[model samples]
Target: MREMVFEILTPREIEAKSMETITKELGGRTWPEPEFSIVKRCIHTSADFDYADNLCFSEDAAKIGVEALKNGADIVTDTKMAAAGINKNKLTSLGGEVHCYISDPDVVEEAKSRGCTRSTVCMERGAKLGKPTIFVIGNAPTALIELHRLINEEGLRPALIVGVPVGFVNVVESKELIMTDDMPYIVAKGRKGGSNIGAAIINAMLYTMGR
Candidate 1:
């Protein structure tokens, strides 16, 4: 076998070098700030350049998301993995918290009774929070569908909706539905997203806010 070579680098150095490589590889693609930051983080997380082209942002969505976080808006994610991936220290310093109620007893019970997915019930619970909230959904399309209903029928307006669930079923349809409304949203246009992507997007906005 040929001799293998590897560079030894600290975590920070590795991250920095990875970012530099990503930037260099991006070449002449000039994405604006905020959006660029979000896309870069997504690419870094998955090592997939498609995110650069696949991420869809509503007008001023990134600006609104940053502002909301600065003002202590809570973040509710459909998956615990997404919530866990967010930097809690940075978020708490900004006076916000991340939540995932998918596994809550009430959510499960309600979902069972109503014959809906737990993610759907989680959105209902999140809507009742009655505070400024940013919904980060990265697993369940049903959550996005319910969110759209809450917005159109129940007047539940979130600060920002990060809809990037990854799957074949209803994933594209759910994203399309959320985009139909004029709500502030950052969505992955196709089915190429996940919990990590959602968390990365949130962290990107937080980093941009310097928090």
Candidate 2:
């Protein structure tokens, strides 16, 4: 059996959309600013809103995604487990974008083409609380050092940082930062935590279809 071709959308053109609301929300989540607490009421006397705008994935992943969303995650990240890690029937119930970031485009396309990983990158940007922060090194100590920089530079505010080069080298640090760090913002780690590792991390997050 062959894999499906994973379509790639450059992040370049994504800036032009009316993401003002989304960005604001993302920023608000990471940052505890009072301005984000304001709620807007849309009196749709006739219009109907639905969760159809969300992207779909495998049953287990999808189940996990729902829980993540409930747990306050605007985006869900995951890596395809083997040829058929994700489910399709549940995906059909999804709309919006299914972001599936991969370090190697070739492997992604192959996985999709063969139905090994039928996923998509949910192209929704979480509201930026601040600017893009940089994290270097792979090991735990190095990651801690970089995080200290983020706190010192931005004071644990809303931030958007790339988590690439993840693996035995620095993944421990990255995970530490993600799970325990004080930085409030969205981060994308390159595949796995190694070769194509950055892409794997990215793939996991991309699969999170924003509700």
Best candidate (score: TM-score): 1
lDDT of 2: 0.30
lDDT of 2 by residue, 1-211 (tens): 9989964655533422323444453444331212111111000110111111211111233233333333433221233321122233333344212223333476457656765431221111112222222221122233334444545664543222223333455554544455354443222232233213222222333244431
Q: Candidate 2 regions off by >4 Å?
A: 1-144, 156-179, 184-192, 207-211
Candidate 1 residue spans exceeding 4 A from truth: 1-5
Give the least accurate 10-residue stretch of model 1, judged by summed lDDT. 28-37
Single out the weakest 10-residue window by summed lDDT for candidate 2. Answer: 37-46
- TM per model? 0.96, 0.26
Error of 1 at 191 (Å): 1.0
